[model samples]
Target: MVKYLVVFEKTETGYSAYVPDLPGCIATGKTKNMTEKHIIEAIQFHIEGLIEEKIKIPISKTEADTFVFALK
Candidate 1:
């Protein structure tokens, strides 16, 4: 399985998502839940496009923010 980087951000209208690996492929939704769901579908489409186009690019990350989470 390929691990793609999924980025989600809180927006004024709700939230949006993007996959770093697939440039220019943007997806938005009215809520975070919907955004995530759409992102998955977007990723699938992106992968299919890459395969058909014979692209060999990989996803890279350069995070602007870091966070730590603790289990409660």
Candidate 2:
């Protein structure tokens, strides 16, 4: 299975998520957990639609990392 990097952001009301490798694939929910679930479903559905349309599925090449720095 191909893995895509999902980015989650906290909004004023809730949370939103989107896959970097899958443009236009996004989902929102009232909580992080809920958003995570919705995003998972969205990715699955997005792939299915791509397959139905005979479009080439995008390969996951996006990666993410966090860097912490201290101020002196």
lDDT of each: 0.82, 0.97
Best by lDDT: 2
User: Tens digits of per-residue lDDT for model 1 on 32-56?
Assistant: 9999999999888888898899987
TM-score of every prediction relative to native? 0.75, 0.95
Best by TM-score: 2
User: Which run of 10 residues does model 1 get worst, by summed lDDT?
Assistant: 56-65
- Measured on C-alpha atoms, candidate 1 has an lDDT of 0.82
Measured over all alpha carbons after superposition, the RMSD of each candidate to the real structure, in angstroms, is 4.6, 0.8
Q: For candidate 2, write residues 26-70 as lDDT tens digits.
A: 999999999999999999999999999999999999989899999
| Regions of model 2 farther than 4 Å from truth | none
Each prediction's total of clashing residue pairs, residues at least 3 apart in sequence or on different chains, is: 0, 0
Model 1 off-target regions past 4 Å?
57-65, 68-72
